[model samples]
Target: MPSLSPSSGQSGLSGRTPPSPSEALTVYVVDDEELIRTSLQGLLRSMQLDVRTFGSAEEFLAAPKVAGPACLVLDVRLRGESGLAFQQSLAHRGLAHLPVIIMTGHGDVAMTVQAMKAGARDFLEKPFRQQEMIDAVIGALEADTRRLAAERSLDELRSCWADLTPREREVLGHVAAGRMNKQIAGDMGIAEITAKIHRGQGMRKMRSRSVADLVLKMQALDVIRRAA
Candidate 1:
C-alpha cells in the first residue's frame, strides 16, 4: 500500500535495541488499502520488525521468497481474490511454512472458522487493538523461528552424514544398535580398538557429544534410522 517503502526503520525505531542477526524477523502485509498498510507498517516497524507492505497478494507473491522467520498479514477480502482461498491455495502450492494472520473489516463466524481451518495463525477484526496484533505477530514469528531452526539443524545433520565415509556409516549403525566396541569388532571381524577408532570418527563427523545424542541424530538423519 505504501509502495513497499524501503526505509530500514532506523529513524522509526531509534532508542530501541536492534535485533540480532539471527533474531531479525519480517512481516509481509498485503492489504489493498493504503491507509491500512501504512498504519500496520508503522506499528510493526516501531516494534523493530522488518515490514514489507503489498497493495495486492500478487505483488507479495511476486517478491523473492525469504527463508527466515516471517509472517504474512493478509486481509480476508482482497481485490479479485478471496484471502481465505488464497491461504488454502498457498498451502496447496507447498508454502505452508509462511504463516498467515488474517484481518478483515467485515469478518463473520464462517470466515473465521474457514481461515482457522486453512491454517491461519490468528484472526483480527478491523480496528483491532495494537497489542492484539503485536501478540499475533510475535506468536507467528516465534513459530517460524522454531520451524526454520529445526530445518537448519536437519540440513546440517544431513551434511555431516554426507561427509562420513562408508566405514563410518557402518560403525554408526552398530553404535546405534547399542553394540559395544568388542561386539562390533566381532561382527565386522576387526580389532576392538579399530572399532573404537571408527566409532569415534563417526561420532565426530556426526557432531554428536554423547552416544544418546549420536543415536538420536542418526535417527533423525536416517543414517541408521532402521536400526534405531
Candidate 2:
C-alpha cells in the first residue's frame, strides 16, 4: 500500500482539507460537531489521506457503500441516535465487516471495553494525539483490506467447489478425512483400482497438486470435519 499525505483547500461542511496526492487511505469522519469534524478532516488530509466528513450517522448511512480500502472514524455521541446504536444497527444489518474506529469525548474505560466487544477496530479519546489517530486509521485500513481479500478468496473457492461432480465431492471428503485409496474403496464398496482412478480425477478437477494442498483447500472452504 502507498503512503498518504495531506492536501490543501477546505471542502465539505467541516472545512477539513482533502488528502494529499500521495496518500492512498480513504477515511470517513462522522461527528455532529462541525469544528471537530473539520479539524479531523484537515488533520487527515495533511497526512495525504482521502477524507469525507458526515454531520450525523444518518448522513454517513446515506452515502454509498465504500468500494475500496477504507475505515470509518465515528463519534460516540450524535444527536437523535447514539453512535453505539448506529454501530449495532450496522452489525445487525450485516455491515459489521466494515472496519470502524470509535471516537468519544466522554469516553470511559467501560465504554471503550464495550466498543471493543462490539467489533470496533480501535477507540480514541477526544483529546487524542495526531499520531494516535493516524495509527488507528492505518491499522483499521490494513485490517479491512485483509478481510475483504479473505472474503473474495472464500467466494472463489466456493465457486470452484461448486463445479465438482457428486462423486468428486465424495472423494474430496474422504481425502480430506485422511483416508487412503484402499480405505476409501472399502467405504464406497469399490475396488482399490476404481477408487484410485476416482481419487486421481477428483484431485485433478479440484486443481490440488498434492494431498496437503487438497486438505488445506478443504479447510479453507470449511468443508473439512474432524472425526467424532
lDDT of 1 by residue, 1-228 (tens): 322223344343333333344756999999889898988898888788899999987898888767678899998889978788888899766688898999998989999999999899999987776666777887888888888889999999999999999988998889888889999999999999999999999999888878899988877876565542
User: Taking the tens digit of each residue's C-alpha lDDT, what string does model 2 give over 52-82?
Assistant: 9999988988887657678899898999899
Candidate 1 Cα misplacement greater than 4 A, ranges: 1-23, 224-228
The numbered model that scores best in TM-score is 1
Q: What Cα-based lDDT does every candidate model obtain?
A: 0.83, 0.78
TM-score of candidate 1 relative to the true fold? 0.86
Quantify how close model 1 is to the true structure by its C-alpha RMSD in Å.
5.2
Off by over 4 Å in 2: 1-25, 190-194, 226-228
Clashing pairs in 1: none
The lDDT, on a scale of 0 to 1, for candidate 1 is 0.83
TM-score, per-candidate, Cα-based: 0.86, 0.80
